[model samples]
Target: MDQKLTRQAASRVPRPLAQALSVVEEAAQGTKLWCGVTAALACLGGRRGRRAGTAGLAAVAVAQLVSNGMCKPLADRPRPPKGWIPHDEVEDRPDSSSFPSGHTAAAVAFAAAAAPAWPLVGALCAVPAAVVAVERVQSGAHYPSDVAAGAVIGLGAAWFTRRSPRLLRRCTSRPSP
Candidate 1:
């Protein structure tokens, strides 16, 4: 079912839109686009933006570690069948375990983590995040389930990072010695 939906999405998307999405996908490679956005926010967006950017980048890093380092290895899911996509976009597809897309994970993690500190910036980030997720499917690089799992992982990483400081404070403020 996931593969069928992925193939349908890949096949039905118009060529121009697919081309645009391919560009988005390329920009999101290794989370470069998100990192740049985070850096800009930190540099120019003042105190709140800096905090948000830091948290967002940290969440993305955690998401990457979990999605690419752990989940992909454990699930070992294959990329969507290349044969289903009859377009040049297919050539850009990655040769990695596809479950829990690292791009989508980083995208969501960065956006969600930033939202708490800077809602507007987070909202802005969401546009590209959404595009990256859809492009993963439209390019036949990931199944729908893979994207969904990636989103969940990304959100989880953001949530965990948001709470971690309090956890650390509690552990450290124990009236040591």
Candidate 2:
């Protein structure tokens, strides 16, 4: 597939930004740091961290399932060739649909869920968010709006999950132990 003119234009991300994105991608994809970061954020809830853990888990679960399983397939977006990813810098590549970036969704959802618990750490969430957003566009995997929407979806899912405990308890309620 031919590269979108927009993607080709956006691929001009600076060298330093590209390097920074590489580092962020490495962190997010390797060692499940996203999960670890969320777990640590849950810890900030003090005794409530345990409870928050459950909610955080639910948030992350919903986000991943929605982004990777449902949205990505439905959208059927394309990815840039191996070299086209700014750092990768490819020439000819197959075109895929560019909508609703999964990486962005996952990263944003995690940030939204954990940010409430650990405000300081929550700030770091943007690092991955930015990295994934840039990486997806730079790689021709997605358009800018695709990533924006994904962020909205992911963050919205996390927000709903965080706020739904009352609903969850109401549904899961049982006789007091």
Candidate 3:
């Protein structure tokens, strides 16, 4: 069922849409595009925007580490079959394990983390995040389950980061130093 769905989604992507998604996929390389977006928001949003941008970037970093470093290695799942993708995109496909998509993780993490600080920015960030996730499937780089897992990991990372300050305060409050 997963394979069937992935194939169906990949096949239905039109050339222009695929080209656009390919650009998104490329920008997501190493989460550079998202970092840039977050930085821009920070610059434009004042103090509150800065805070949200910082948190969002932090969450993205954590999600990348958790998804690519830990989860992907552990899962060691293969990417979707090459034949499922269009010829032009074949070379753009990553060679790494694909259980949890690092790109999608970073996207969702940024949006989820940023939304708490600035609802408008957070809401805005969601658009690209959703595109990145769908692009992962549309580009034939990941299965639907891979995108889902990445989203979950991203949300978890954001939640953890949000709670870190409280956790640190509790730990330090009792310290002798």
Candidate 4:
């Protein structure tokens, strides 16, 4: 099923859209796009924007670490076969495990974390995050399940970022006997 879906996604998307998605994937290779967004928010958005940018960056970091460093090592899943993806993108695919997409994870983490700080900006971030998820499949970098897991991990990272400060405060506030 995963292979069949990957093949379909790779073949069915319109050429123009696929090209654009490929560009987006490239922009996201090292979380470059997210970092730029964070910078834009921090510089132009004033207080709330600064908070949103910081939170988004933090979540993206956590999500990238968990999806790429921890989960990828543990799962050891393989990328979709190049035969399934009828494009030059196959040559550029990562050699790493594909159980979770680091790009998707970071994208979702940034969008989710930022949304609470600034709703409008959050929604805006979500658009590209969704694009990255789709690009992962269409480019044969990940299976649908991998993208789903990445998204879940991203949400978890966002949750951790949001709660950690308070959790730390609570832990410290409890007088060590």
| TM-score against native, each model | 0.94, 0.72, 0.93, 0.97
Residue-level lDDT of model 3, residues 21-66, one tens digit each, is: 8787788788888778867877887899789889999999899999
Q: List per-prediction Cα lDDT, in the order shown.
A: 0.90, 0.65, 0.88, 0.92
Give the Cα-based TM-score of candidate 3 against the true structure. Answer: 0.93
Query: Relative to the unseen true structure, what is the C-alpha lDDT of residue 109 in candidate 4, on a scale of 0 to 100?
Result: 97
Deviation from native of the Cα of residue 34 in model 3, angstroms: 1.7
Residue-level lDDT of model 1, residues 31-66, one tens digit each, is: 788878878987899899789999999999999999
Q: Tell me, by lDDT, which candidate is best.
A: 4
> Over 4 Å off in model 1, which ranges?
174-177
Worst 10 residues of 3 by lDDT: 84-93
Query: Model 4: how far is 27 from its true place, Å?
Result: 1.3
lDDT-best of 1 and 2: 1
Roughly what TM-score does model 2 have, to 2 decimal places?
A: 0.72
Mark the 10 consecutive residues where model 2 has the least summed lDDT: 87-96
Q: Which of 2 and 4 is the better model by lDDT? A: 4
Order the numbered candidates by lDDT, best leading.
Answer: 4, 1, 3, 2
lDDT of 2 by residue, 43-102 (tens): 665655544445445666777778777887787866544554554433432353456766
Candidate 2 clashing pairs, residues 3+ apart or interchain: 77-96, 77-97, 78-96, 78-97, 83-88, 83-89, 83-90, 84-89, 84-90
Worst 10 residues of 1 by lDDT: 85-94
- Give me the overall lDDT of model 1: 0.90
